[model samples]
Target chain A: MNPFIDIRNDFPILKQQVYGKPLVYLDNAATTQKPTTVIDALCNYYRQDNANVHRGVHALSERATVNYERTRDDLVGLIHANNRREIVFVRGATEAINLVAQSWGNANVAAGDEIIISAMEHHSNIVPWQWLCERTGATLKIAPMNARGELLMDQFDAMLHARTRLVAVVHQSNALGTINPVAEIIQKSHAVGAKVLLDGAQALAHMAVDVQALDVDFYVTSAHKMYGPTGVGMLYAKEALLEAMPPYQGGGDMIRTVSFERSEYNDLPYKFEAGTPNIAGVIGFGAALRYLQSLGMDAIAKHEQSLLAYATDKAESTGYIRLIGTAKNKASVLSFAVNGVHPHDLGTILDRDGVAIRAGHHCAMPVMKFFGVPATARASFAVYNTKDDVDTLFVAIEQAYAMFS
Target chain B: MFDLRSLYQEVIVDHSKSPRHFGKLDPCTHQADGHNPLCGDQLHVYLHIKNGCIDDLSFEGDGCAISVASASIMSETLKGKTLGEFEALFDRFQQMVTAPVDQPVADDGMGKLTVLAGVREFPSRVKCAILCWHTLKSAMHADSGVAKTE
Candidate 1:
């Protein structure tokens, strides 16, 4: 019996039918389906505690503010962060990376400075640094990945020098499911006096991500990936760095006192957080994290690994499906292609059987270019997915292969 | 609205596997690159236009079955047609694919292009099916530049 299969009932969306068939959602890397707890929390917040946070003196506003700030504190424990002030809330991982790029990156990166990123970074992580390079005249150096989609650590070490200011890399590749050697990257980067920022958007959901243990300077991730509300995520920075860096955007809540001339910025996290926050979303995000904790990360990781291995083996056994991103160490993603068919063709075919999967570059074009394929169909596992879902995927793949070939 | 079999009919698969007018033209006159950045589908439409008549037209790119087949079917139907006729074809094709899924397409001058009528079911794939026509439109009027389906 599968250890994790029993929890599927907790997620009501998984029990529904799609296209006159049972829905087998394997697109976790894109975004996860929410459990009823998260949904109910979001509903309850808007229904009961509906008010603007931080500004209004009303009881609803106080409740909203308390709940909103609670997510930041929850994130501190979730990522093993030291203090609540170290955690900063933003729209999502994309905006968190941009915050680092604009606030910290703008101040540090110079014309001759180097920002080292891996080939497997999402567009969110890649583009912000690329834009920073364009603005600051710094060079964006790429640490190449091997054929199996694993990063070359030796090459990454070689790339780092005194000129390297930051080593921004993904903790796990969304496209390939390759869990990177972030710990080593951080140690080596720090040896050369370069700060490390890990894009933990995928990693946060799949595995146990402890920012303190990793000792990385910055760790960015989103909530929607972890079965939370969309448009709410966290950036974990060391308090010293948070104190040193400038505010990303100039607005309310980020200031101590505003004036015509100048304004003193707020504390560590609030300095980064600007304007009216996503109050209900933040409340929902806290509930999501709590839900994940209740399930236990170790159990979720094991269940997902089993699913990944089972799906990978079954997909290869079909003989028509060619698996991409075959790293020795990987996560819940299984990206593959049919023998003579495009990924989208396979996707449309699978959709007929109500097996939802993501077929694209997965927002990692550089990884696609490295693999020399336009796109790959990915079936990513979540807490609620089971072996039956994997079986359904293979059955659909064989049918699609026959139809396309 | 998205009927799976109707969208991936036998014709789309055949054209995608063995795309007609698949390679680049040697003496290419009017050319424009088309890109569906969201899908990572890129095609370069090559036209051999002379005296308002499409002498020869072909495309070279990598895309989904829908896109590649649409380009193939489009090239096959558009070889001997004049510029005015190509415009009419573009209009009707766009109308057919972009039309609401519930509405039926009136058979104007689309010809075999109606094979692509299924694209209307999948709103996202509509960009893929019509990318070649947009490139063809750019090749007709503009000298040389990329055409984007935004």
Candidate 2:
């Protein structure tokens, strides 16, 4: 397959029209658009295999159970987890992190125990640990970053002490597009017997992730950001941790038996997934993974890298456009602010021209405060994005500058 | 190159570049701050009311063209109106922006605010356009003075 030429055909939404112009969607960091295969999988599941799993005595139930379990196997393959039992489904990355924080952090972390996180973490990663620290009397320590948005390795090393219980870091920053050294982070945390959880919400779709090789204790990702359905995500934890931690919720599927005297819990992954799951969404997520696998992550990464380089060159040459998030190792995101033009106004003008870029903190307010700006105009790329899209952005930015100047 | 004329019309750009009353009122009686955190647009509104009528009004903040222009025109229109008239105008403004129309024009007394009648076309930006008005209303009803900072 010609990586760039062929893959754009799979996503039907790429052909959409916004304000009478062809849509140039560069908001993949927010949520990805679905491909035909994922949409078809959703429609097929509801049309043919729509039934409650595990308990019903009907054929549809049996089919649903098989397909749902197949999704678990797909995730196991995708992340290269030790076993299928390590994968637990949740609402999204936020809920998955909350589950670990509330269940595991509450149980293990004690007063004065240190939980380390980086400055680059999204609010989802930061707020949960803050809540846990407040509830458990644990202290939250931050691993600071340098001026260029790169994590300060020396600072991270200094922050890790014997009291450090867990180190949570983002695999790729949603706002800055920085590809963090999670393999190094896992190695360092493990050296001090601290567990590591990498927020793969932005990383999973853009890079190749192998949980087994990285030896990460826990990893989380959201489906909506991966061209799959929303309200469905995966959490990969070490099998031992899953067995030791208490279940996050209690309901029908997570129980083995219940009586007035005592109640027995269900097995591994089901213990974490407490209710009738988002069956259709899970099926679609599996299909999205299959679609990605077919395209090959290495090819997708290469295509996106080229697009990023092209965009960076275009924005730099345009003059008066100050690009933010210029980390050494970054993904295909171009965040910038034009001279003398507010990001909100630039976003408005671009939207009128059928170019969709996110204009705000990108849900990483701490990063915005770090940069000393209230907001930025971010144009993030995906599998379907092309050089023409970047050209459109450059043209719109030039017009914005001309209007203000 | 893309054309900025459709979205940043001359009137809209004019208001954004040279916004009227784009500063704070010292020792102001009524002041409120408005924000649209989603887009990071902010407006600080200040009004001096005397005898239930607007004696003076001013604004200060950072926002898109539509938002700044809306605030500028809103402040200009609100300059001599009574408190009751301001409330009525707020309702009319809300209706004009939120309601569906085919090529709606800003025929209301508020000049250059008519430029923002184009804002009704972009549903997401309606919040940006109306943020200043929301701040004004909150300022009008505050016990001391409400500041809606986000």
Candidate 3:
């Protein structure tokens, strides 16, 4: 019996039809369908406990602050961070990365310093380091990946040196659906005395991540990818490192006190969270984490592994279709190209059939260029997605093939 | 279900698969690059204008069916047209695709290009169908920058 049976009911949006066909949303890598609990959390916060956090003299403020900080506590457990102070909420992974780049990057990196990243990194991870390099005259290095989309550890090892200050790479390739060997990457970077930051935007949604076990210096993820609200994500840093790094922004809650001569900053997480945060989104994200925990990440991973295997086998049977990413260790995402159809055209046909998939560069143009394709159509699965969704995806692929070829 | 036929007409598919004038034109009077970053569709439009008339033109690029077909059809239609005539045709083609779907587009002057009016139904794809024409317009004006359909 399928354990995920009737799980689709939890996501109210899944019941809707698109173009008169049942909506088979396969774009989980892009963003997930929010569960009813997450939606209710959003509504409940606004309907009852809507107030500014961290500065509440009133009852509503205390309730709002309690709920908002509860997410930080949930995140500490979600990623196995050492403490609540280690988890700072930002807008999303992009903002989280930018915060690290500006705060820690400005303080630590300087001329002749090296920052290493993988070729499969999304533009968010790449651009910030480039900006850092441009600002401080630091040199940026790219760790190569093979045709199969797995990172070349030997090449990466060779690139690392004492000059390599930071090694930032995606925990999972959103474009290729490859789960990189992050543990090995971390250990190797540490041997060379380089700090590592994992772009956990895709990883947290599909797998169990323990930052303490990984011993990663920094980790960032978006809540939306994990069936939570957008514009709210968390950054996990070691307490010592976050303490030493300069604050990312300055405003109301981030500071302890201000005077004409100087202003004192707040402690740990609050120091980084400048200005008004996404109070409701954070509350919704807390609910999202609870929802995922209720299902158990291990069970979810096991279910998604089987689904990915099923989808891979089905895609392989199509002799003309080419799977873009064939890493030995991959999950959730199935990026592919039909023999004659451009990804954009295939995407359009699939949408007409109500099988929504992500097509094009997927914000990883370097990966596309490496694979020698202009773009690829990606069908990523989530917990609510079933084998039936995989079947619908293949049917749409055939329809696109028939129309284009 | 929305019929794929409305979007992917037989001619559009044919042109996309076997695009006409699908290469660069050397010794061209003017040219401009075109790119749609959203889908990664990119193309170069080249024109050889003599006495203010398009003497020869060609394009080379990778794009979706709507874009490749639109460009292929445009290449064939504008072969002997003057600069002024190209502008008028561009206006008519632009109007046909951008106008309200309920409003009927006149087919009298559009010829084969009328097939692209189907894009009015898919707003996201309207940019794909117009990328090459925008590039061509840039080429006509001798603009050196890449024309983008955002």
Consecutive 10-residue window with the lowest summed lDDT within model 2 chain A: A1-10
Task: Give stretches of model 2 more than 4 Å off.
Answer: B1-7, B103-108, B143-150
- Candidate 1: give the clashing pairs: none
lDDT of 1 by residue, A63-102 (tens): 9889988888788888999999899889999999999999
- The residue-level lDDT of candidate 2 at B30 comes to 89
lDDT of 3 by residue, A275-384 (tens): 98999999999999999999999999999999999999999998988999999999999999899898998898899888999999999999999998889999998999
Provide DockQ values for all models, in the order shown: 0.59, 0.54, 0.77
The model with the greatest DockQ is 3
Backbone clashes in model 3, listed as residue pairs: none
Please give, for residues B33-125, the per-residue lDDT of candidate 2 as tens digits: 787887777788898999999988999988777888888888888898999989888887887777685656546675555666666767777
Per-residue accuracy of model 1 over B18-113 as CA lDDT, tens digit each: 999989898977888998876778999999988889999999999999999999999999999988888888888888898887888986667888
Q: What is the interface RMSD of each candidate, in Å?
A: 2.8, 2.3, 1.4
| Candidate 2 structure quality by residue, lDDT tens digits, A286-363 | 998998888888888998999998999888887798887888999977888888788887887888778999998988
lDDT of 3 at A325: 93
Docking class of 1: medium
Model 3 chain A: worst 10 consecutive residues (lDDT sum)? A396-405
Best candidate per lDDT, number?
3
